[model samples]
Target chain A: MKKYTYTDKKDTRSGFGAGILELGRTNPNVVALTADLAGSLKLEGFIKEFPDRFIQCGISEANMIGVSAGLTIGGKIPFATTFANFATGRVYDQIRQSVAYSGKNVKICASHAGLTLGEDGATHQILEDLGMMKMLPNMTVITPCDYNQTKAATIAIADYQGPVYLRFGRPVIPIFTPADQKFEIGKALMLNEGPDVSIFATGHLVWEAIQAGEKLAEEGIEAEIINIHTIKPLDEEAILTSVRKTRCAVSAEEHQLNGGLGDSIAQTLARNYPAPLEMIGVHDSFGESGTPAQLMQKYGLTADKIVEAAKRAMERRV
Target chain B: METQQLEQIAVQVRRDILRMVHAVNSGHPGGSLGCTDLFVALYFDVLRLKRDDQGKVIFDMDGRDEDLFFLSNGHISPVWYSVLARAGYFPVSELSTFRKIDSRLQGHPATAEHLPGIRIASGSLGQGLSAACGAALAKRLNGDDKHVYVLMGDGEQQEGQVWEAASFAPHHKLGNLTAIIDLNHQQIDGPTDLVMNNRDLGEKYRAFGWNVTDMKGNDLADVLRTLHESKNDSEVPTLILMHTEMGYGVDFMMGSHKWHGVAPNDEQLATALNQLPITISDLKDY
Candidate 1:
């Protein structure tokens, strides 16, 4: 297993905040719009620095989406920020008609995704966002793992001229990725390489996968770990190459089992190379209020769950 | 252009709407006929349109330093397509391709086919005002002093997103944006008041902090004067409640909601064409 360590912990939304600040200074045409969540979205600095460019959309997610789509006409990049639930489910038709179908250059930056939103319960927690956004024809879905990666992804999306859904979370997680890394949109990062089992993870489950890799290595089992940041426009070549070598796979995410990263990887593997696959995610249930650690453990999103799934896949391998 | 000249173009446009819908045997002709005079006044007189060096019209999608218009009530795409062609946005002969397979002129206006003069796709209701607000803000950010115009159906105001956008524009002080509500009092189901009563539209816009005005949409002179007056400097966004008949200028179809989406048949088409004669101009027939 490849050695990985973190010196600090930070929330991914703060990374987005840092990225937008830099983008505001560099790109004059970059504008920010929030659906009454500027403080929660960590957009105060961007709003303060460039007051003229920011628009407080005042709890109107659908209108905010339409406005963002319209902003692209005269060469302005708009970032519409809100929670995951309101961002995807509440205003799906607006995004579908105005942004996705129109192919507008707008960034849908969603925070407080999955159970890691912590104590907000299922009403605020959204596990179906990735699937919903991925189903759209012209949408690129992304969920960066940590602060550094989320920051890099935020800045990188500005240069990409298309509609994108950048999903992040609220909990403060370990920052393991490099600070100055160039965030590639659809490329998978190989964290650890082995031949026994391939572990594909995204968002909060990425770090847990790394921990599982270390634990499996100590037990005389080799595990290959890959971080899938971009869910749609998925790196099929990288996933197939790893699964072909390992012969079995375990997918992990802080989302539902039906339409999360596991579902995506399962479809890709089923089409190309069938293998013994185990998924670690919420199994068709709503989350309740709890601490982030407790919720993750209760929902089977911990390293132990990944390690068990990896072992199960290896055992089922022919 | 003179008011008489604009009225002549509107007559030809009404003929085109009837013929185009009759050709496809499917389209919305009521609102298209009702809003023909307003479209003629804007395209011919009000807008500082894009023109080539020889003063001929040129169609450009990007509206920087130019007045931009959006049709929120996109069911009336026949009328928009007619005025767009008559204003030299595209060849007038393209009007025959309306709603045909693989044609740029979609049943509802769309940007997918790379159609000139269409910036966003808005078949779904209540999205155009928000888009216009975004464009207006973009023009302000780019230091371009231009206006943005959008038209909506009276029944389309029932959509929740329209109210959301309505609340947003006045709060943000979008002075350069003008929204015209086609108060024809008719919709797909029935009369808009019966389907869903929009009580006192002028008062509703006034309460939402808009500069409200009323105009006769079928009258070329009133449309020309009211549209010119609405463009003056103001502290709030402008809303013009244009009162018009459902199927104006057609004696049999006027003042009724039956012709909203149903196209005219052969006999009806001939009767409608006789009502709107081909004036002394070089406009072609499809």
Candidate 2:
């Protein structure tokens, strides 16, 4: 929990691809469908190894979601793979009617989520997918932190008997979470426990939270960093337990502040136990074409921002 | 079992559709009446669904190893719900609870209500065909030769997702799926041509690489023949464009798009019931 380090850095999408290949070997019922982004989503290994199990859905994301919903009827677990924009907002009605409302066990594995999908501009970079998917009934929204956690979460959701939105990114972030860690759906991973402030981070921001935690530790602020992988079935208890001890909280994510991880934590705190909170994310602006690192800094989704927000939240602590 | 018997059941299903809509005053009767014969022909005779040891249809969400049907143009819940009950998917008496609060018979066909025959929710148009394509692909993967069927309205063709699915089925060679479009030429707005004309839908499907078939939707014998022809064309997915009048059975409502989503008043309901002669008596009337 002190200082975290990574031996390698890889894109989380590759972990999704690796996870698909693993499912191809183990679960006969698992099938992968992609909207012509197999290469971007890193699904070549699964496609080559289990060609029969892979479906190339062309550029039709709506049909892919509907098809994924249908595959569940005949006892096949379908992972409908696409970019975050095409996966959630584009085919939201298809997901709502067929997957979520119908209670079909389809895993909507989305790659290139958030501002971290560098240089594609705002059209390809989807910041509202988490909120869109989470608002639907029977939808499990997940944003795993690293490659290992993304891979683990990919395999873990197939066992769940409902629809899931597993959001990952194209950027090569650090692989800090253990490769052999058993992925729990709603359980938050306590990366670092402290009493000063609670830093709840998800997706790409989890690594940034650790960076901020170290910097805060040098300033004599022991920040509690908890990785909130599952955003919809949020580990409310973990949030409460951490925030109750710290008396203040800061939520970080590579998304909008309005409906991202921060809003989930805000609502939980407001209902169960009121606490001073600061949110670190994009403040209602579309991301432009830029490097992932540049975009993170520009959108206020970096470690310095988290540290700044943490200090602000600590200042407002009663 | 016989065409005559199927017609007898169709008459009662029509009565149920009219009465169900009349009771609720908030259901689609035009499309429901239009697709009555097709629904009866499929559920009562054509579909090869899984039966128990004693021949009772086993109703499960994951209907593996059996034929599956998904209704995409689900505004016609009256027709589907009545047919399912008449097919013994649920008690016919429960049909009385159609559109009532907390009843399983929702305004649209939804799996959330745990309805026996419905595999997925559909009311928002243009999604069912893709689901059928997926189910057909699943059948191919599982090595189960059982079929997947889906029904869509003609006006529902305006949805771009339908074309996405239309292109997919033949491209993937989903021969195990049969997609039927009720060519009622009517949506909630008005005539489909007046709304947005989809010129030659069968030609469009054929261009999309489907084995296109034309069926007289209201005609029971033609519906059965189309089903047989479609069931045999298992190398490429078949699209049966079922040309039907908007309101087929009732003399006054026949061929009118005005009844597309409007429930009949008391007088109109009585008039519609008078035109339909019930012959299937073994099933309880809702």
Candidate 3:
């Protein structure tokens, strides 16, 4: 087992802000819009450098989505930022008709996703965003694990010519992935290779899965850790290849058990290869006011939950 | 174009509106008839559209040379399609394809089927204004400076997103954008006042920070003059409150909400066509 160390923790949105700044330097067509959450979404850097290109669309999320779609007409790549709840549920129809159905080159960058958006309660957190966004025909859903990966994904989506939902989180997590790692839109990253069991995780849950893999190694369990960032594309080849080797799997994410990353992997496995699988996510319930760490433990999204789910899935493998 | 010629086109547009609705047996005629003259004025006089002298030649130009129009209240597709056809965007014969399966002209105007003249899909009300605003912004970005026009039903003012867009354009100072409200006072259920009272729309737009203007939509001269005036104001996005009878031109259907979404019967269609001073052959060449 390889022990990963972190110098300092940072929220994934800062990585997005940095990536957008880099994009501004490289591509002049990349513009940004925020719905009164510019500071929260970490878009101040981009706003400062490219003030003319940055649109502050007040507190109206619906108008923001529409304006983002409109910005794509003259071949401008628009990145619209807001909270996950308002980004998806609040402006679904706007995104549907304007961005998604219209096939506009708009990146719907959402921060503070799922239960990890703690203390804001269920009203602010959204667990069904992945399902809602991925269900759209031309939508590309990406949920980066940490700061480095989020920055890489943001820069990457600027060149991708279609509607993309880039989901990130509020909490400062481990920055384990290499700083120079290139992000492929639909490709999953294999963290540690093993055959005992495959653990697929996304967003803020990736660090937890890595920790679980280290703990499982102490118990003589070789867990293969795979980062499934792009949930819509679902890296089916990588998932099936790993599941074939391990013969069992455990899926983890900060979203709900019904329509999160786990549900997507489960459906894929059910059709292609039958494998024993356990899901580590929030059950059928809304989140409450709590710290990020407390909510992770209370909602069964910690490293221990992943380790337990791995053992349970291995037991069912036969 | 002369006022008399524009009036002749308006009569022909009204005739097209009646025939298309009667053919489908399921379309909105009242607002379509009401907005006929305004659409005609926009396509014929106000807009810098590339057309031949005969008004039938498809002016070959790159996508960049195109001037765009979006019908936010797309229930009035008959008027828009008629005007587009009359303005040489496509063949006038395509007017027969309204609401028919395998037709580019859907019940609502959409770009999903790659309708050449339509830049965005706009069947769903209140969404088109934002889209038009987007297109207007795109024009600014492209440095094209081409105008973007959108039409919304007076009843469609109930949508919150419309106000959202209304508030947005002026803040951005989108001078290239123009939005017209078909102030026929009628919607799907009944009169807009009865269903959802849009109290003083001109004052409402003024409150939302738009340069407001009013015109009698059925009157060709007023439609042309108001639209021309709207183009001159470069600091604010223009909104025209086009006052018109729900069912204009047709005697039986005029001044009532009953003909809003209902198609005229066979006898009613004949009477409506007879009321027009122009013949169908004169419009068929358009």
Candidate 4:
């Protein structure tokens, strides 16, 4: 087993900030809008560089969503940033009517996603965001793995036209993916290829999946790890191909079990090729005040939980 | 156009409204009749859009490229479709297809079905003003100073998001946008005052940092004058609280909430049409 190392542990939002700045320089149509979460969403650099393009929409998320939709009329690409909870569930109707249904090419950049946005409690931690956003038509949902990939995903969504929801996290995690890798929207990145069990992971859980794969390898269980960054257009080919070979599947994410990445994978496999599947996510409950690490452990969202789910799924793979 | 001509158009529009409502047997007629004159003034004079222009028209008055109108209170499709038809946005004969199957004139104005004139689908209320502000902002971004006009029902203002947008537009100095409230004082339930008292709408908009104005929405001359006044003031977003009577014409339904969502029967339609000056010589039963 190979050990992954990182020089520093920085929040994935820094990657978003860096990507936005790069986008500002590359594309003139790129504009940023924030709902009084400039510092939190890490859009300060882009705002500083392109103050004219950066629209401070104050605390009104609904108005901000509408304004973003309107900005598309003049052929401007707007990337609206806010917390995942406020961006999706809080302004669901606004986004549904204005952006999604209207088919506006606005990138809804969301930060502090899932239960990993710790200490905020259940009020701010939105585990149902994926379900709410993915339900809308013409919406592309992307949840990148780490700092480098988050940056790559942010930059990629700018060029991809139509409405996109780019979900990132608040905590710092492993940055294993290459810095210069081009982020494809629906393409799943296969980290480890094996045949016993397939582990599909997204967002902050990708690193955990890799760790679980390593542990399973030591136990003579060859677990394949695939990072499903795009949840909406769930890379069906990669998922089905992997599940067909492995015969068992386990999905891990720091989100609720309902309408999460696991649900998407299960639906895909059930339709194409039914396989034994286990989901490692928050089991129908709200998060409480704790650190990201503590919450992940308590809510059964860890590498060990993935290993356990994988073992259980493998046992059911007759 | 002269006031008489505008009045004549309003009568024709009222006739069309009754016919369409009667045809569907399920459409809002109260706000439709209340907003006919404002629609007439907008299509006839205020908005510099052309009927035959294939491409988007850029009105030169705003010094921006294009001027567009969005109907947020889309339940009043009869008035907008009638005005668009009368103003030649589409064929006047198309008025017959109002809300029928396979017709561009949907129950609400939807751009999804490629309805030539409409830009966005707005029937839920409290969404159009914000969308209008966005289009105005886009115009500003495109270096097109063209003005954007949106109409809303006074009762729709009760939605909290409307004020959220109302407050946002002014704070951002979106002066290119003009929102008109059809102060017909009636919603589905009853009077706006009884349902939810929106007392001092002008002051409320002013408090939200909008340049508020008042006008008789049914008076063509007043609608024109007030809309022109709204265009002149570019320092802040303007809100026209146009006071209008619910069910303006047609003596039987005038000043009442009964016609808010009910369609007219054959006798009622005939009675309503007779009140208008226009001769419906060829009233086709669909």
| lDDT per model vs. reference | 0.92, 0.91, 0.86, 0.86
For model 4 the local lDDT of residue B253 reads 83
Clash pairs, model 2 backbone: none
C-alpha lDDT (0 to 100) for residue B46 of candidate 4? 81
Candidate 2 lDDT, tens digit per residue, B1-286?
A: 7999999999999999888888878899998999999999999898888788988777987777888888999999999999999888998988889999999999998989898998989999999998998888988888898888899998999999999999899898888889999998877778889999998998899999999889999889999988877877667999999999988899888888889889899999888888887776523453
lDDT of 3 by residue, B90-189 (tens): 7789888889999998888766666656656666778888877777777777788678788898888999999889999999999988999988888878
Q: In model 4, where do residues sit more than 4 Å from their true spots?
A: A1-5, B50-64, B90-97, B100-104, B277-285
Count backbone overlaps in model 3.
0
Q: lDDT tens digits, residues B23-50, model 1?
A: 9999999999999999999999998877
After the best TM-score superposition of candidate 2, give how far the Cα of residue A288 lies from its true spot, in angstroms. Answer: 0.3
Which one wins by TM-score: 1 or 2? 2
User: Ranking by TM-score, best first?
Assistant: 2, 1, 4, 3
Interface Cα RMSD in Å, per prediction? 0.9, 0.7, 2.7, 3.9
Best by lDDT: 1
Q: DockQ ranking from best to worst?
A: 2, 1, 3, 4
Error (Å) of candidate 1 at residue A227 is: 0.9
Cα deviation in Å at residue A150, candidate 3?
A: 1.0
Docking class of 3: medium
Off by over 4 Å in 1: B280-286
Residues forming the 10-long window of minimal summed lDDT in candidate 1 chain A: A66-75
Model 1 chain B — which ten-residue stretch has the worst lDDT?
Answer: B277-286
**Predictions in order: chain A TM-score:** 0.99, 0.99, 0.98, 0.98
* Cα error of candidate 1 at position A43, Å: 0.5
- The numbered model that scores best in DockQ is 2
